[model samples]
Target: MKTLWDYTIVLQPDNNGTFVAYVPAIDGCHAWGETPEAAQSELENVFEMIRDEYIEAGQALPDNVELVASHAR
Candidate 1:
């Protein structure tokens, strides 16, 4: 079972009054909603579906990329 910390989710607002969320490490793993909270909730569903697909095929989830800030202002 994968934990929430296993992946990094990027949530951004769109110009059209909606929010978009996606996992950088997983292709096609994304969702959109009217708010940031909604977007994240939808993203959870998307990730679960993708995770199950990988499991049924006996594959491990891809490791999340480490994001670090190299510089600070």
Candidate 2:
């Protein structure tokens, strides 16, 4: 059985009140939804698609990473 990899995702609330999510390790991989939960669900789908593409192309997967949440005043 193949081991499942987990990637850290960053979720941020935009000015419009919607939530946006992205994987810090994957460039151009992101998704947005009205709620944080929805955003996270959409992001999960995006991650799977990107992973599949990488597998098909024989490309190395993005490195697993984590980002600390910080607020800017």
Q: Judging by lDDT against the true structure, name the best candidate.
A: 1
Cα lDDT tens digits for candidate 2, 1-73: 1112377778899789999998788897799999999988888788888878888998888677766768999
Question: What is the C-alpha local distance difference test score of each model?
Answer: 0.88, 0.80
Candidate 1, residues 1-73: lDDT per residue as tens digits?
A: 8844589888899889999999988899999999999999999999999999999999988989766657767
Q: Model 2 segments beyond 4 Å from truth?
A: 1-5, 68-73
TM-score of each: 0.85, 0.80
> How far out, in Å, is residue 25 in model 2?
0.5
Model 1 clash pairs are none
Worst 10 residues of 1 by lDDT: 64-73
What candidate 1 gets wrong by more than 4 Å, as runs, is: 68-73
Clash pairs (backbone) in predicted model 2: none
Could you tell me how far off, in angstroms, the CA of residue 31 lies in candidate 1 after the best superposition?
A: 0.4
